[model samples]
Target: MLLFSRNLDKLFFRTLEKQLALTYATSTEPQREEEFRVLNLKHVKGQVAPRRPLKKIVPPPPRTQQMAENQDWGNVWPGPRSFHPATVPLPVRQGYVEKGVSPGKFGNAELMKIPNFLHLTPPVIKRQCEALKKFCTPWPKSLDSEEKCERHFPVEVSSSDYCHSSPTIRDPLARIVSVKVKLEALKLDARARDKFLRLVGDRYDEESDTVTIVADRCPLKKQNYDYAMYLITAVYHESWNVEPWEELKSEADMEYYIWENNASKVNVEKIFGKEAKDIPQIEVYSSAVDKYMNEGESDHTVEQYGQAVRKILNLPSLGA
Candidate 1:
């Protein structure tokens, strides 16, 4: 029974080894066929899509060459913008010369980079004015004369406007408001005039008697304008007010020499005695002092002052 079992086991092993060799031969035959098929592909060329013909580029006609002399300028440029050479009809040129000739308008970067005011032609301005005429009110008949205009509009408000192609349209000086009015327009008395002058300081023009107030600290023009008007109103009202301390001011504290002051009046009274009012050259003396103090000192002013002084003191002239 043991020998029979051993012989059966040997037969089983032999059958298994033969089946393994057959399986290996079958797998290797398919792999060898795949390798031969891949090697054959190397000789074959790859297929490509057909190429299309390129279209020719046609250049545009020069706008300047096509434009006529009778063409409307307003139509060409309706508003302010960056310069464009092609749109402009003029034979304009820019760029520095390499030899004797400058670069023409066709491809001029310099011409296109800068600002242009071509839209603001005379004809265009006339047309714009005509269109805006309906919105504008007629000039007042009462303000026909310059004096009447000044009288009616006592305060003249001045401001500027700037236009450019930039990140901001606003200019620093554009917001500044300058208000001017004649000193006489305010109808201030001597005391008020002095106070107003003091309040305004150097802004008051003594020669022209015009007070000019400039407001620029504010951000907006309207705000500056309002501030200027408020300042003018405040100064005007304050000038009219009489402070108790102002009454204590003596001749020495006065800004300019006054004939009505204690020193001048007393001296004149003492010199002329009872006829102080009838003193000769009193008006001339006052005028001389005013000119010397307010107007300016000069050879003529000094001579006038000396003459007035000598006359007031009753000193004999060199001719006498």
Candidate 2:
């Protein structure tokens, strides 16, 4: 009985000791006052403070209707109220409309207004005559008529030295053959005159036998040619007193003067008269005259003869 009692006390003590050891091992601090307190004091020594909780940012209460109305901030008026911004108004111009316009037209008669230009001079008449002469093709009759040698009536040039745009006497012989003009002759007979007079304006002076039909302004082809002829005739008759022998500056001007004479054979005669009609001399002058008169040849201007002047003078060519 005593051995059994001793065994029971040993079992009881062992169980209690195991419970104490377990309790000691689990508890971080001493469970009883006499227990050893060996622990990691370094972790306890350094205090890790808890993180501060993030403050929830609650926005101020939405603007109240009464406050909005008072402040004039969020309150919007009704019926197409201009709450949004507007662009600056453009500068307004009222009721300014463009009108239609166009150029004017002139009648045939009105088109012919004479420029009230200058009277004719000798040089002017000569130049005009040269221009006319350039267009003068040989009449078809001249080629066949060997014996007759009938020539084209030269458009004449005569000028008074004293004439300063003053009207001078005209040569009766050089008065352009207005006798056969279609309009004038028509005017002479009452039968055809009125119709033509109506056709062209009343610029014709029937009593004076002086008819002025401006060709540029006139619609008729015959009138144009007649007007041209009349102009040449007027210049020729008006300039009759101009000196013919006055020495011209250039050979071309001299050639023009030579050709202006009524007689066609004068150029040949003039060359022969000066004893300068060598074969080469005749050739050069002939070439110059041909160039001036004939369109079949190359178009020759006055500058071409500038070289010929030195050639004619028997001077060596400067090649300028």
Candidate 3:
């Protein structure tokens, strides 16, 4: 039994330690107190600050408000450009709407899409005219009448310029050039004038005595103008040009009656011999017959011819 006791004490061995009373431990400690901490915020490092509200911005008043009534428009709008609401002092509006006034200039497409004459005011025009006056020559006092002007400057050129709200500034009709001039201005002889009239066809206005040349074959205005001028020059020179066949044209092929080449002159010569050529009465007879044949028979023509015949043959006038 003593040996079993010795084995039990060896298996359940206890460690030796020094012990002190509770009062002695309380006295040895420097300071002993109870303490508390805030819940769930012990790990936070910095102090929290409140957020301030954002400030609202107010824009400056419209530029037109500061403008004066007598302000120079030329300085306001220096040149051609799209319309601006703030720049223009006027209350102009354009866009259409149901049961509403025209839309204001701000955010308006109608105003921007079209051109404005803001830079071309009356004062501006006067200033431009004054500046240009030095470079211009004064009008000739001698050309007081329209007829006088036409007599001196015979050629009248006409063309058009178009302005519209379109995708492109160019208009097809603007390229066409029209040139007109009086036929008398060409100073052509009888044969040359007849040839010119034939070459120009119906372009000639017999009543106005003017010929109009229209050129639209070219794409540009200047090109069409040049083409029109070339046509006029060509027709003028061509009319004067004489072909070999022209000399072969007989009396029968003549456009008008020729009193000198007719049998009437031959018979008259046979009657009076060479003296008919010197007779003043024979000349009047020739003019009357020429007019009667060329101008178609009329009362005036017949009366004129009868008087000439009476004068040549020394007969009494029927008017008596």
Candidate No. with top lDDT: 3
Clashing residue pairs in candidate 1 are none
The superposed Cα distance between candidate 1 and the true structure at residue 301, in angstroms, equals 4.2
Ranking by lDDT: 3, 1, 2
Q: What local distance difference test score does each model get? A: 0.85, 0.44, 0.90
Counting clashing residue pairs in each candidate, in order, gives 0, 5, 0
Q: In candidate 2, which residue pairs get closer than 3 Å at backbone N, Cα or C atoms, i.e. clash?
A: 158-239, 158-240, 159-239, 159-240, 159-242
Name the better of 1 and 3 by TM-score.
1
Q: Residues 216-276, candidate 1: write the lDDT tens digits.
A: 9999999999999999999999999998999998867887766655475677778678545
Residue 52 alpha-carbon offset, candidate 1, angstroms: 3.1
**What TM-score would candidate 2 get against the native?**
0.17
The TM-score leader among the candidates is 1
TM-score of model 1 vs. true structure = 0.73
Give stretches of model 2 more than 4 Å off: 1-214, 218-226, 243-274, 278-281, 285-320
Give me candidate 3's TM-score against the actual structure: 0.63
Output the lDDT of residue 306, model 1: 91
Stretches of candidate 3 off by over 4 Å are: 1-55, 98-100, 164-171, 255-320
Q: After superposition, which runs of candidate 1 have C-alpha atoms over 4 Å from their true positions?
A: 1-51, 141-145, 263-282, 290-301, 308-320
